[model samples]
Target: MPITTNGIHHEERGSGDRTIVLLPGFGCSIACWAEIAPLLDGYRTILMDLPGHAGSVGAHADGDLPTLAETVYDACREIGLTRFIVAGLSLGGAISMRIALDHPDEVEAVLGIMPWNAGGTSAGDPVIEGFNAAYGDIETITAGITSISNDPTKTTDLLHTMPTVTEKMWRGWLGGGAFTSMADKLPGLRVPAFYLVGGKDFVVNQAKQIDDVRSIPGGRLVLHADLGHLACYEEPELVAREMLNFLDTHAIAPA
Candidate 1:
């Protein structure tokens, strides 16, 4: 794992034909992608822990979406990744969207999994708030995440390696100011994109969000009826396979 001054922790694997940057959701560390990354062994995968999460707990910034996007961009630059597919879940998905909109030259494509549109309410807001209230209380926070996670055992194992996050970071996660503002910028984004959602997700309307994304030329949507908010974890192998297929359709060059 490599660490950046801005408090981003990342692990890289399989220097293959394509570079796939994986970003986790709010309060989640890079380990969230543990099951998913290995499945992408034929491709280069970079799993990143956003600031204020995991080993990067003290990492600080404006804590807004744009700043988060820049932080990701900086992390990629620090590691010499200029062009790659940026895939994100939940909050990470929103950040990926911002990156695609603001720095199209650096991002070849975006995979947004259970992404929250800034204009809508998050389905798991109550759960997130309750967890944040117990930020330093590791047990409480862990329990909260497990309740929402598709696989409690795997998620708990991953969380055990990280320190408790702060209330500020939690606030940043819930604040959709950055995501909501992104609607205005979407029209300008030309990158090939994939919008994925779990059919059971109640945090946001999958169909509506997909409709919004489809307004963009070449945008595609995928919905898994058996999954929910944490679809990547619930179906890592399937998601990884679908991701590779999407990339192939989009013609993303291998690294």
Candidate 2:
């Protein structure tokens, strides 16, 4: 069932004490975390759609990363999560970082999958141009994302939701208009941070991600050479195990 969080669409599951909030990548729904959510066996889980995608499609317009973060924060508060961990992929990863940065006291830990270093910076030109060219046409945009994805067929639903994604979302989220340099923020991070970088994710710079990890007091980076951008999709079980262990290590109690 779809519930509202300050009018935002979200879903909740699990019955554990500590909660894990899962935010998906572009055009993704709570379904994006299906394979991994179960691995988080003993914790409460909340999965959400960003403003312009999935269940929350078109709920808000002209929103920036921080704006989206606030929406999610409001949702979390409504869901009654006093102490929780946040994890995301791509766009979600960027938002997770924002959440951790802005509310250090609330977010217990963070896990990012190909997350961007959110501030006044963007990825390479090729990736930016690709989205710009396919902005209005759903077919074109879906095809573009499918081409880079590790498993195109698995992401069909995400592709279908592409049409709802707005140009502002494209420019601000994917096209890289939103940013806050992590170089200066990581050292000051209050939680444990982990990044999983795909070897073939051409959109993000692996080197910079590693550097971001180095800055954190105890951040760690895991690289998978055979994987592409949606690495979690390619080997969800493996990634889930890793995610579970990382959380367990940092978690006050085992989930």
Best by TM-score: 2
Candidate 2 lDDT over 41-91, as tens digits, reads 888888888777767764663447778888888888887787789999877
**Which residue window of length 10 is worst by lDDT in model 1?**
172-181
Candidate 1 lDDT, tens digit per residue, 1-255? Answer: 579766778888777867999998766677668888888767899998877777667677445777878887888889889888899988788888888888888888988888866344544467545754665677876666667666665566446643355557666655533334566666677788888878777555676677657666777887788767776666788878878788887746645
Segments in model 2 whose C-alpha atoms lie over 4 Å from true places: 61-63, 119-124, 175-182
Question: lDDT: which candidate is best?
Answer: 2
TM-score of each: 0.86, 0.90
